[model samples]
Target: MWELACLRFRHLGVSVTPSRCYRRQASSHIYIWDFLTMKRLLGLLALSSLLAGCASGLIDPNGYDETGTASYYGAKHHGKKTASGEPFNQNALTAAHRRLPFGTQVKVTNLDNNRSVVVRITDRGPHTRGRLIDLSRKAAEQLRMLRSGTARVRVQALNN
Candidate 1:
């Protein structure tokens, strides 16, 4: 019983001791509300940090450029509806961006092999945080990134 109580306290990021056991002694009981307040504060801090990162969220086709890791989608999502409400085609010269508008065309260059491909933005998101773009399986092949499954790429929006 004591071990279980200690484990619970530890999971909550609290230290526990025999003398601090609440059930054993009324006076030793720690107010549950104090821990609840701590939990709430910690959660708020995390949320704020997440929101702060979204300051540069959108990828603009004009004057927007960035260098980051790129990945691709394949057979598993070959025909699923994407965020833009269009069916995903793993073989098309299509890609997903975090916020670049649908129908926007961008050029993705694999930094590893210097291979490049211009792909149209057909969907929203790479889903994973910190990733800049997600290419289709066919695009990945053109960049020769199919074997490694991912590559460092420079994404640039093309002139409309």
Candidate 2:
């Protein structure tokens, strides 16, 4: 049993000289613990730095809001090409903002009744002058503003 255990430790690269096994057991145990400690610390350090790098990609969410008129487009615009090169789908939660980047996501809040919906920016207009953002049929439905065709809204960009 002793021989087998010594051989197993050797196979694991933990040097255990046969002559010193009985005399230096405590010293060898200390050496093994020190080696393991270094390996664990290096692993922890690598993991922490990787997580920090990922955390740095996030942005502050304050000051991303815009208050203005919101509108929706349905059937005719569905299946049509959007400015983002994707086909518009009325059932999807999407929107169009004149100045927002094509793939940005914004939270559209109906200021009149305080209802809100998150929509992805997939197209580019209200083309009608005073409006701020054009939401898809589904987004409008979520905001409960389909009947008025337009609503006072607050559009806020999401950092993620």
Estimated TM-score for each candidate:
0.63, 0.61
Decoy 2 TM-score against native: 0.61
Judged by whole-model lDDT over C-alpha atoms, candidate 2 comes out at 0.83
lDDT tens digits by residue: candidate 2, 1-160: 4555566568767767898676766666666668768999999999999778646644444557889999899999889999789999999999987767667888889998898898998887889999988999999998999999999999899876
lDDT of each: 0.84, 0.83
Weakest lDDT window of 10 consecutive positions for candidate 1: 24-33
Write candidate 1's Cα lDDT for 1-160 as tens digits.
5555555566777777766664544322344546668899999999998777654665557976889999999899998998778999998999998888789888899998899999999887889988989999999999999999899999998898
Q: Give candidate 1's root-mean-square deviation (CA, Å).
A: 7.5
Please report how far candidate 1 places residue 9 from its true position, in Å: 42
Q: Among all windows of ten consecutive residues in candidate 2, which has the lowest summed lDDT?
A: 54-63
**Every model: Cα RMSD to truth:** 7.5, 13.7
